[model samples]
Target: MKYLLLSIFLCTLLACTPGSATKYPYTIRDFPDSLRTDLRKIVNYGFIGSPSYESAGNIRMQISDNDCKRLALSEHPILRSLALDILCNRHHLDHYSIMMQHLDDTAYVNWYYQCASFTFITVSDFMVKEYKWYTEEEKNRTVEKIIRDHNYLQSAYEALHKTTLTEAHYPFVRKMAEKETLMKFRSEALLHLAGYKKISDTGFLHNALYQSRHELDANAFGIMELYQDPFYFAMLKKYFPGGYYRNFCKKDFERNTTENALSYVSALASYRSEESAAILEKILFQDPLVPCFPADTFRLRQHLYEVIEKNTCEHYSKMLRVVKPWLERERKESAENGFPIDTTSFYQFPSDSTNPPKIRW
Candidate 1:
């Protein structure tokens, strides 16, 4: 009986080995020699020395520093590059967040205020599709949080600025305003004073600050939709001066007016109005690149095609006339380059697998 059991166990072990039909398939390609060697060193130093290294510093610092040292001694170019990026990011976590946030904020303001309503709609659609990782509840909560924080910051700034405006606490306000650390405080105060009758009115003004606040809120929503997080915008504001936001918007307006006009054309195409379609053709004739931003251009054209498909033959004709040349050029380029052009659409809806599907005419 013991011999029979031992033989059964041996057979079971052999049955589970790779290439056996009973074994699940997995890919286990060998790592590059340099990467394999460095990986081994990292494991050895990280795990084996961890107990002794506990006295060193934070876990992040110790691991990154040790890994970097090992990478420096490594001869593999790719591994060295990867290690350097990891070390740099680990070392400058806050700085990277700040820079990315500023860029995002700047982009948000420009897209929100200057772009056509259709552009906003298309971009919003793109953002939602691009960041479908976040659950609906998560997205809603994040947006609400951002709005609440923005309101709080705006209120605080208004209180400080009101004292300055009345000259009651002018010197203190001036001093606080001069410090770079308190710039958001100062700007919010100034904005509050400029927009509101008094400190008591700050809440009311924020609640009803129709165009500017709404535009800002929309931009924030756009960012949240794209990134699935609100922390990025705060980080952006932390690094770049708030003054840059206004300046960036102004520059985008001046440089992108023609582009914006083209967006209007794309919007007309989507709406399938004969008047707008005629205007689009004129614009397309003048400048082949209408909506300059690649993402915007792709989205605009897509919406235009969708409108054509669902609405009328006129829209279909208009789209073909306007887009055929571009599509043909793209196809030729894709063929030459051996890469497929991506033209995909995404629609978002609640997932309830247990519920029956509903049909609509």
Candidate 2:
């Protein structure tokens, strides 16, 4: 027992000795000093929530009325001098030094947050416009890219998993798998591409892999599908494969629905068929509680009433007026088909504890 203890002690001491384990064969520290310096600058200046540490005066002064013209003339000595002065004065060497040590750490965080927020705002606006800016070529390119990226991820994972022996390799392999899955799942670019194509070709809009209205961009196709067509809704279900619809249905009703409905109503007004009018009436008189209830259903109804009164076709005008009273009655009684009366069921409204007024006569 004494001999065994001595052997254990010797082994522990050896393990703790300096340079006992072999160092990695490669080191990133070998990168050139100039490259390292630039990298460091990126890290320091890009950290999230890190103080800009730049002088407010410098930031303000950088934005001149003629800055656009100066930028266009990229080789201008004056512009270059101004830029250098700003960099040197606003961020001291100490700040640059700190940034170099953690270059990617700060840069990646800042880029990720900026991209994420911008994507959210862009998507929301795009959806509101039914993806007006998206073109066919762009959609196809996005789809192809997603396919390529996904295949590359798969190949990398398979290669690593087959060759690695150390247990430490498992974490990396697992991470690759997760990344691939997430790309397949929440790849907004790919999903939007598919959605844009589907809507343009089939009159049906589909949801993206992820809903980014709050973070990246809201799926315009998804919004249209929710309000306009059952076909697009089915596409959303097929792609998402879970309770995605239920979650989507819970968004602010009047805001999303009213916008979509208005767009649809305006586009269909020229058709003037009974079917179209009936569809308009149905939308205009939906139960205020439905997920897609218009924000201004009352106003929409009043407008429709005026349109009907002014129509040149006597029969069409008569039919519209006839339908208007029934719709109004249904709205008052909370009895519109497919539309519920309680808008507050899908979203909370700001109000005191007092009971809401009843719509009944």
Candidate with maximal lDDT? 1
Alpha-carbon RMSD to native, per candidate? 24.6, 20.1
- Judge candidate 1 against the unseen true structure and give its global Cα lDDT, from 0 to 1: 0.36
In terms of TM-score, how similar is model 2 to the real structure? 0.27
**For each candidate, how many residue pairs have backbone atoms clashing (under 3 Å)?**
2, 10
lDDT of each: 0.36, 0.35
Q: How close is candidate 1 to the true structure, as a TM-score?
A: 0.25
Candidate 2: where is the Cα deviation over 4 Å? Answer: 1-117, 120-257, 289-294, 306-312, 318-361
lDDT of 2 by residue, 1-361 (tens): 9999999999999888644123212121333343334323433454321233232233325443233223212232222222222332332233222211211110012212343342121111121112211234443332233233432332232223123234433334333423433342333323333333343433311222233222212334333433445443333333321232233354654234334333233434434556555554554455552344224556555555545544435435645656567657766776535654686668766775454332110
Instruction: Identify the leading candidate in terms of TM-score.
Output: 2
TM per candidate: 0.25, 0.27
